[model samples]
Target: MKKNKLEVIPLIDDFSQWLAEADKSDNTIKTYRAVLNQFHEWLLSEGMDLNHLKKKDVQQYITYLESQNKSLATVEKAFATISMFARFLKKLDVVQDIKRKQKDKKNQEAPDSLTLDECNHLLAEVKKRRQPS
Candidate 1:
Protein backbone atom coordinates (compact mmCIF):
# COMPACT_ATOMS: atom_id res chain seq x y z
CA MET A 1 0.00 0.00 0.00
CA LYS A 2 1.16 3.49 -0.75
CA LYS A 3 2.19 5.30 2.40
CA ASN A 4 0.26 8.46 3.15
CA LYS A 5 2.42 11.53 3.64
CA LEU A 6 1.91 13.03 7.09
CA GLU A 7 2.61 16.70 6.61
CA VAL A 8 5.45 17.56 8.96
CA ILE A 9 6.98 20.57 7.22
CA PRO A 10 5.57 22.91 9.81
CA LEU A 11 6.58 20.66 12.67
CA ILE A 12 10.10 20.34 11.28
CA ASP A 13 10.29 24.10 10.97
CA ASP A 14 9.06 24.68 14.50
CA PHE A 15 11.35 22.01 15.87
CA SER A 16 14.35 23.64 14.21
CA GLN A 17 13.45 26.92 15.89
CA TRP A 18 12.91 25.30 19.27
CA LEU A 19 16.11 23.30 18.95
CA ALA A 20 18.07 26.47 18.22
CA GLU A 21 16.65 28.16 21.32
CA ALA A 22 17.02 25.08 23.54
CA ASP A 23 19.94 24.81 25.93
CA LYS A 24 20.59 21.21 24.92
CA SER A 25 23.94 20.04 23.61
CA ASP A 26 24.49 19.37 19.89
CA ASN A 27 24.40 15.59 20.39
CA THR A 28 21.16 15.89 22.34
CA ILE A 29 19.52 17.98 19.62
CA LYS A 30 20.64 15.48 16.97
CA THR A 31 19.23 12.56 18.93
CA TYR A 32 15.92 14.36 19.42
CA ARG A 33 15.70 15.17 15.71
CA ALA A 34 16.49 11.58 14.74
CA VAL A 35 13.80 10.21 17.07
CA LEU A 36 11.21 12.69 15.84
CA ASN A 37 12.03 11.86 12.22
CA GLN A 38 11.56 8.17 12.93
CA PHE A 39 8.15 8.88 14.42
CA HIS A 40 7.23 11.02 11.45
CA GLU A 41 8.13 8.15 9.10
CA TRP A 42 6.02 5.74 11.14
CA LEU A 43 3.04 8.10 11.06
CA LEU A 44 3.26 8.34 7.31
CA SER A 45 3.40 4.57 6.95
CA GLU A 46 0.33 4.19 9.17
CA GLY A 47 -1.60 6.88 7.32
CA MET A 48 -2.02 8.85 10.53
CA ASP A 49 -2.04 12.60 10.87
CA LEU A 50 0.42 14.14 13.33
CA ASN A 51 -2.32 16.15 15.05
CA HIS A 52 -4.46 13.04 15.46
CA LEU A 53 -1.81 10.87 17.16
CA LYS A 54 -3.04 9.05 20.25
CA LYS A 55 -1.38 7.51 23.26
CA LYS A 56 -2.08 4.03 21.94
CA ASP A 57 -0.21 4.92 18.79
CA VAL A 58 2.82 5.82 20.84
CA GLN A 59 2.48 2.57 22.80
CA GLN A 60 2.29 0.58 19.61
CA TYR A 61 5.38 2.32 18.28
CA ILE A 62 7.25 1.35 21.41
CA THR A 63 6.14 -2.24 20.93
CA TYR A 64 7.34 -2.15 17.37
CA LEU A 65 10.73 -0.96 18.52
CA GLU A 66 10.93 -3.86 20.94
CA SER A 67 10.00 -6.33 18.25
CA GLN A 68 12.99 -5.09 16.28
CA ASN A 69 15.18 -6.23 19.22
CA LYS A 70 16.14 -2.74 20.33
CA SER A 71 17.70 -2.56 23.80
CA LEU A 72 15.51 -1.32 26.67
CA ALA A 73 17.88 1.62 27.21
CA THR A 74 17.68 2.61 23.55
CA VAL A 75 13.90 2.34 23.55
CA GLU A 76 13.71 4.47 26.67
CA LYS A 77 15.89 7.12 25.08
CA ALA A 78 13.62 7.18 22.03
CA PHE A 79 10.61 7.61 24.29
CA ALA A 80 12.30 10.55 25.99
CA THR A 81 13.09 12.10 22.60
CA ILE A 82 9.49 11.69 21.49
CA SER A 83 8.27 13.14 24.77
CA MET A 84 10.22 16.30 23.99
CA PHE A 85 8.50 16.45 20.61
CA ALA A 86 5.16 16.04 22.32
CA ARG A 87 5.98 18.90 24.63
CA PHE A 88 6.83 21.01 21.62
CA LEU A 89 3.49 20.13 20.06
CA LYS A 90 1.68 21.05 23.23
CA LYS A 91 3.48 24.36 23.34
CA LEU A 92 2.14 25.08 19.84
CA ASP A 93 -1.35 24.02 21.00
CA VAL A 94 -1.36 21.19 18.49
CA VAL A 95 -1.98 18.53 21.08
CA GLN A 96 -2.77 18.06 24.75
CA ASP A 97 -0.83 16.12 27.37
CA ILE A 98 1.14 13.45 25.57
CA LYS A 99 3.65 12.60 28.22
CA ARG A 100 5.00 9.06 28.10
CA LYS A 101 5.00 6.70 31.06
CA GLN A 102 7.62 7.51 33.67
CA LYS A 103 10.61 5.25 34.10
CA ASP A 104 9.91 2.42 36.51
CA LYS A 105 10.63 3.49 40.07
CA LYS A 106 12.90 0.51 40.52
CA ASN A 107 14.95 1.70 37.54
CA GLN A 108 15.09 5.31 38.75
CA GLU A 109 17.48 4.61 41.63
CA ALA A 110 21.07 5.75 41.23
CA PRO A 111 23.63 3.11 40.41
CA ASP A 112 26.11 2.26 43.15
CA SER A 113 28.97 4.71 42.87
CA LEU A 114 29.71 7.33 45.53
CA THR A 115 29.17 6.51 49.20
CA LEU A 116 28.01 9.12 51.70
CA ASP A 117 31.60 9.61 52.89
CA GLU A 118 32.86 9.93 49.33
CA CYS A 119 30.20 12.50 48.53
CA ASN A 120 31.11 14.51 51.61
CA HIS A 121 34.81 14.30 50.80
CA LEU A 122 34.16 15.46 47.21
CA LEU A 123 32.15 18.42 48.47
CA ALA A 124 34.94 19.34 50.87
CA GLU A 125 37.54 19.16 48.12
CA VAL A 126 35.44 21.46 45.92
CA LYS A 127 35.08 23.93 48.76
CA LYS A 128 38.82 23.79 49.49
CA ARG A 129 39.63 24.62 45.87
CA ARG A 130 37.34 27.68 46.04
CA GLN A 131 38.92 29.07 49.18
CA PRO A 132 41.04 32.27 48.89
CA SER A 133 44.78 31.88 49.38
Candidate 2:
Protein backbone atom coordinates (compact mmCIF):
# COMPACT_ATOMS: atom_id res chain seq x y z
CA MET A 1 0.00 0.00 0.00
CA LYS A 2 1.13 3.57 -0.69
CA LYS A 3 2.18 5.48 2.40
CA ASN A 4 0.62 8.81 3.34
CA LYS A 5 2.36 12.19 3.36
CA LEU A 6 3.47 13.81 6.60
CA GLU A 7 1.30 16.65 7.82
CA VAL A 8 3.21 19.84 8.65
CA ILE A 9 0.36 21.46 10.57
CA PRO A 10 0.28 18.84 13.31
CA LEU A 11 4.01 19.17 13.79
CA ILE A 12 4.13 22.93 14.26
CA ASP A 13 3.53 22.94 18.00
CA ASP A 14 6.02 20.25 18.90
CA PHE A 15 8.54 21.53 16.38
CA SER A 16 8.38 25.04 17.75
CA GLN A 17 8.60 23.75 21.30
CA TRP A 18 11.59 21.61 20.46
CA LEU A 19 13.37 24.47 18.71
CA ALA A 20 12.66 26.81 21.61
CA GLU A 21 13.91 24.24 24.08
CA ALA A 22 17.06 23.81 22.06
CA ASP A 23 17.75 27.52 22.50
CA LYS A 24 17.75 28.11 18.75
CA SER A 25 17.49 31.76 17.76
CA ASP A 26 14.14 33.04 16.52
CA ASN A 27 15.53 33.65 13.05
CA THR A 28 16.89 30.13 12.86
CA ILE A 29 13.57 28.66 13.84
CA LYS A 30 11.83 30.86 11.32
CA THR A 31 14.19 29.67 8.60
CA TYR A 32 13.51 26.07 9.50
CA ARG A 33 9.78 26.71 9.32
CA ALA A 34 10.09 28.27 5.89
CA VAL A 35 12.11 25.36 4.52
CA LEU A 36 9.67 22.84 5.94
CA ASN A 37 6.71 24.74 4.53
CA GLN A 38 8.27 24.68 1.08
CA PHE A 39 8.88 20.94 1.30
CA HIS A 40 5.37 20.40 2.57
CA GLU A 41 3.91 22.24 -0.38
CA TRP A 42 6.02 20.20 -2.77
CA LEU A 43 4.84 17.05 -1.03
CA LEU A 44 1.21 17.97 -1.65
CA SER A 45 1.80 18.63 -5.31
CA GLU A 46 3.65 15.34 -5.66
CA GLY A 47 0.58 13.50 -4.33
CA MET A 48 2.07 13.06 -0.91
CA ASP A 49 0.12 14.09 2.20
CA LEU A 50 2.95 14.20 4.77
CA ASN A 51 2.31 10.92 6.63
CA HIS A 52 4.35 8.82 4.23
CA LEU A 53 7.55 10.80 4.14
CA LYS A 54 10.62 8.68 3.51
CA LYS A 55 14.29 9.13 2.75
CA LYS A 56 13.54 8.70 -0.96
CA ASP A 57 11.07 11.55 -0.84
CA VAL A 58 13.74 13.73 0.66
CA GLN A 59 16.15 12.62 -2.07
CA GLN A 60 13.60 13.53 -4.70
CA TYR A 61 13.28 16.95 -3.17
CA ILE A 62 17.02 17.36 -3.26
CA THR A 63 17.01 16.33 -6.89
CA TYR A 64 14.25 18.81 -7.53
CA LEU A 65 16.38 21.41 -5.80
CA GLU A 66 19.34 20.64 -8.04
CA SER A 67 17.15 20.79 -11.10
CA GLN A 68 16.06 24.25 -9.99
CA ASN A 69 19.76 25.26 -10.00
CA LYS A 70 19.73 26.26 -6.34
CA SER A 71 23.20 26.87 -4.99
CA LEU A 72 24.89 24.12 -2.97
CA ALA A 73 24.69 26.26 0.14
CA THR A 74 20.97 26.72 -0.30
CA VAL A 75 20.45 22.97 -0.68
CA GLU A 76 22.64 22.26 2.33
CA LYS A 77 20.64 24.66 4.48
CA ALA A 78 17.43 23.01 3.34
CA PHE A 79 18.79 19.58 4.27
CA ALA A 80 19.84 20.87 7.67
CA THR A 81 16.39 22.26 8.27
CA ILE A 82 14.80 18.98 7.18
CA SER A 83 17.05 17.03 9.51
CA MET A 84 16.14 19.21 12.45
CA PHE A 85 12.45 18.88 11.72
CA ALA A 86 12.80 15.14 11.19
CA ARG A 87 14.61 14.80 14.49
CA PHE A 88 11.63 16.37 16.19
CA LEU A 89 9.16 14.21 14.28
CA LYS A 90 11.27 11.17 15.14
CA LYS A 91 10.47 11.69 18.81
CA LEU A 92 6.87 11.06 17.84
CA ASP A 93 8.02 8.16 15.59
CA VAL A 94 6.30 9.80 12.63
CA VAL A 95 9.17 10.48 10.25
CA GLN A 96 12.40 8.79 9.34
CA ASP A 97 15.88 10.29 9.69
CA ILE A 98 15.80 12.06 6.35
CA LYS A 99 19.34 13.29 5.91
CA ARG A 100 20.78 13.65 2.41
CA LYS A 101 24.18 13.93 0.80
CA GLN A 102 25.43 17.47 0.36
CA LYS A 103 24.93 19.03 -3.02
CA ASP A 104 27.90 19.12 -5.35
CA LYS A 105 29.50 22.44 -6.32
CA LYS A 106 28.25 22.82 -9.87
CA ASN A 107 30.47 25.73 -10.76
CA GLN A 108 33.71 24.18 -9.54
CA GLU A 109 35.49 22.02 -12.04
CA ALA A 110 37.13 18.77 -10.98
CA PRO A 111 40.94 19.04 -10.88
CA ASP A 112 41.56 15.41 -11.86
CA SER A 113 41.24 16.19 -15.56
CA LEU A 114 44.30 18.42 -15.64
CA THR A 115 47.55 16.78 -16.84
CA LEU A 116 50.86 17.26 -15.02
CA ASP A 117 52.16 19.33 -17.98
CA GLU A 118 49.04 21.51 -17.82
CA CYS A 119 49.56 21.95 -14.05
CA ASN A 120 53.22 22.91 -14.60
CA HIS A 121 52.23 25.43 -17.28
CA LEU A 122 49.65 27.00 -14.99
CA LEU A 123 52.19 27.13 -12.16
CA ALA A 124 54.74 28.78 -14.49
CA GLU A 125 52.16 31.42 -15.44
CA VAL A 126 51.51 32.16 -11.78
CA LYS A 127 55.25 32.35 -11.06
CA LYS A 128 55.78 34.64 -14.05
CA ARG A 129 53.01 36.92 -12.78
CA ARG A 130 54.55 36.94 -9.27
CA GLN A 131 57.95 38.14 -10.66
CA PRO A 132 57.91 41.94 -10.95
CA SER A 133 59.05 43.39 -14.32
Among these predictions, the greatest TM-score belongs to: 2
For model 2, how big is the CA root-mean-square deviation?
A: 6.6
User: What digit string (tens of lDDT, one per residue) describes model 2 on residues 14-108?
Assistant: 78779999999999888888888888888778877455667777878887987898987888887787777777767323335544455457857
lDDT of 1 by residue, 56-132 (tens): 66777787887888887878887776667777777323223434344579978899999999999999999999999
lDDT of 1: 0.71
Count of clashing residue pairs in every prediction: 0, 7
**Residue 85 CA displacement from its true place in model 2, Å:** 1.3
Error of 1 at 72 (Å): 1.1
| Cα error, candidate 1, residue 68 (Å) | 1.3
Off by over 4 Å in 1: 1-6, 91-133
Q: What is the C-alpha lDDT of each candidate?
A: 0.71, 0.74
